[model samples]
Target: MFDVPLMKKNGSLFAGIALLLGAFAGNARAEEMSLQQAVEIALQNNAELQAFRDEKGLREAGRIRAGLLPNPSLEVSLESGALTGNSGENAFSVGVSQEFLLAGKREKRVALAQKELEVYRWQLTDRERLLRLDAKSRFYQVLLAVRKLKLTEGAIELNRHLYQVAKERLAAGDIPELELNLVQVELARSEGARSAALEGLLASRAELSLLLGGKEVEPALPTGSLEAGGAVKQAQAELLRLAQERRPDLMALRAEAEKGSAELSLAKAEGIPNLTAGLGLKRDTTAVEVAGLEGKDTSYTVGLTLSMPIPLFDKNQPGLRESSARRDSAGNRLAAAASRVEREVAAAYASLSNAEQVLSLYFRNIMPQMEENLKLTREAYQLGEVPVLTVFEEQKKYLEVNQGYLDALYQRQLALFKLEAAAAVELTGGVQ
Candidate 1:
């Protein structure tokens, strides 16, 4: 006896342990990720976003530096006796001087820095939004590629079976050799398609990984469907208004304009020359013989000095003109940005509408009809009532129509993302 009952018990325990380990591995590989997680990862790890953060830090440093006062200067000097005279004397003096701003130049400079910091803040936000769009687009592309690969693989399997059936019919003299050759050609084409789909899927995954700021990422399926959703209900006018109010780039441009104005004010204030004041102390000592007795004398002296430039030249006129030009430029740029936003929003809306219409045509009319035709043609071909070529053509037509529908779905989602980008707000999920 081999301890049959004890052997079964140990086998059962080992099987259960293996299954548990497999389940854990499966869970680890799947790593269910949502669109929000993808965007968050990009924001956290993206190199460009990191650079923007550093730039923001620099702007903050500028603000701190602008609010500080000018440093005082120390002056020291030593002098000795005249060249020819025997009256040897030595004296030393030390002074401290500070330049005081005449107007509110310090305040103006600080205000300018503040405005620049605000601009950088908005720019960072804009950059994050753009990266989110990129990540979402790449994520959806991976999903599309995976779906395409599945579709091609299925087609390849079906075609292979059909080719085998055709070969059997030819050997039995029930189908012509021409039909078998055509089926073989279709099988070859399907295999090629499968290869292309596999390549595309790999490329798409790589792109998504790059966007996620990873050197490489595990091959995981996107957790979503490409189902179409409700149409955009907001009026175009309302969308344009929202874009104007919310777009981060527009806000940044406005901030830049304010900064320019502040800079101009600073330039004007700087034209008022600063006053420099100095204070010093000196000690003098003397030795003399008075009535045959040696006597010593010491004295201390205090001196004050004040000075200012006459502003006759370099009165900051050029700086004023430059700042004025920049302000005007910023105004023009703001107007252009508004127009660009309007155009982008209108274009995206139109594209979304067109994609939705095309999708409706395919799903409501074309797809059902194509599927029915393929089913009927395949049945007829098996009954020897129709040729194999007819069935093959129907299959091809079905594949083409479905592929077109997939493209339309992707376009709709992409248009929605573009609209969000233009409006500088969250619109909808990339895929349904």
Candidate 2:
């Protein structure tokens, strides 16, 4: 005889253990983070961004070096006439000299360095702007993957329920064994799809984690919808104007042009040779023989000297030409960057407009019809009013349509990211 109470007790104990394990697993899962938080983390900890930021320190050091004055030179000398048999005839001298910069060379150097630093700052800002776009793009990719996984899971559940119903109909002699086999095959397909979707989700999460500077083992769950938040209301003209005014890369190019001009001026100033001024004190001693005694006479003297190069051969001709060419190049580059920005903004704007239209169509027309058809087909299959193949076709169609909508949503988000990057302005207010 079986011990009924003992078996019931054992079953309850096993269920309690399973529930506890589930709770522990849920607790161990990483917390969900918002898009803004994700962006902030990336900005703070991303390795590439941090390395770019380190370059600012180098520019700052250059500025420091440019403002500093040259050190003064010191000269000391001793002259002894002992070798020439004049032991008391000796001279000692000390002098200090400074090279004074002419044509405002030091000031011009400082100006050029300051302008270069400004260019670097603008370049760093441009890098940060691109990083924000990248983070947002990756965040949306993870969101799309999550939705795909969920869709696959739902498909698996639906197929499993249909398979169970088909088995019952086969036993009741209302459906053939072939129908049950078909449902079984569809369920297996759904399972395979779910496995692929899970793999995709994991890959997307890993990519997101790397972007956010998080360890690969600690990927945070993204908490947001894939729905298009709002339509881009800005006109192309307005976006172009914004890009011209606010784009950091354009600003950097303009700064570079100014820096080149400063450099040319510095080179011109450098062609003027600096004047070196020296001040010195000297002492001289002499031996005098009078009667039978030797006496020493000493004299002290002060002198000043000034010297400068004639600049006959090297007048920094090469430097001047190089700076001039660089200035012209910078100007041309700025113009080209502006043109590229215009094209990018136009292209992104058109893409976003098209994506919005497609997403709207799916939302208003296609998806509702797809859901209704899937529901009706499922009901008809359960009632034996439709063949198994009809239900399978409808389910597959529903899954395909939903996946297409998800893709549309993902594409629209990508278009928004590109537009924001091109225009160098925030269209949607989030972590920007």
- Cα error, residue 68 of model 1, in Å, equals 1.1
Collision pairs in model 1: none
Off by over 4 Å in 1: 1-30, 82-87, 216-220, 285-297, 428-432
Best lDDT among the predictions, by candidate number: 2
Q: Rate the local accuracy (lDDT) of all candidates.
A: 0.76, 0.83
TM per model?
Answer: 0.88, 0.90
Error of 2 at 13 (Å): 28
What is the C-alpha local distance difference test score of candidate 2? 0.83
User: Candidate 2: minimum summed lDDT over ten consecutive residues — where?
Assistant: 1-10
**Per-residue alpha-carbon lDDT of candidate 2 for residues 55-137, written as tens digits (9 for 90 to 100):** 88898899899988889999999999999999889999999999998899889988998998999989988988999899999
The residue-by-residue lDDT of candidate 1 on 320-407, one tens digit each, is: 9999999999999999998999999899888878888887887788877777787777777766788887878878877777777777
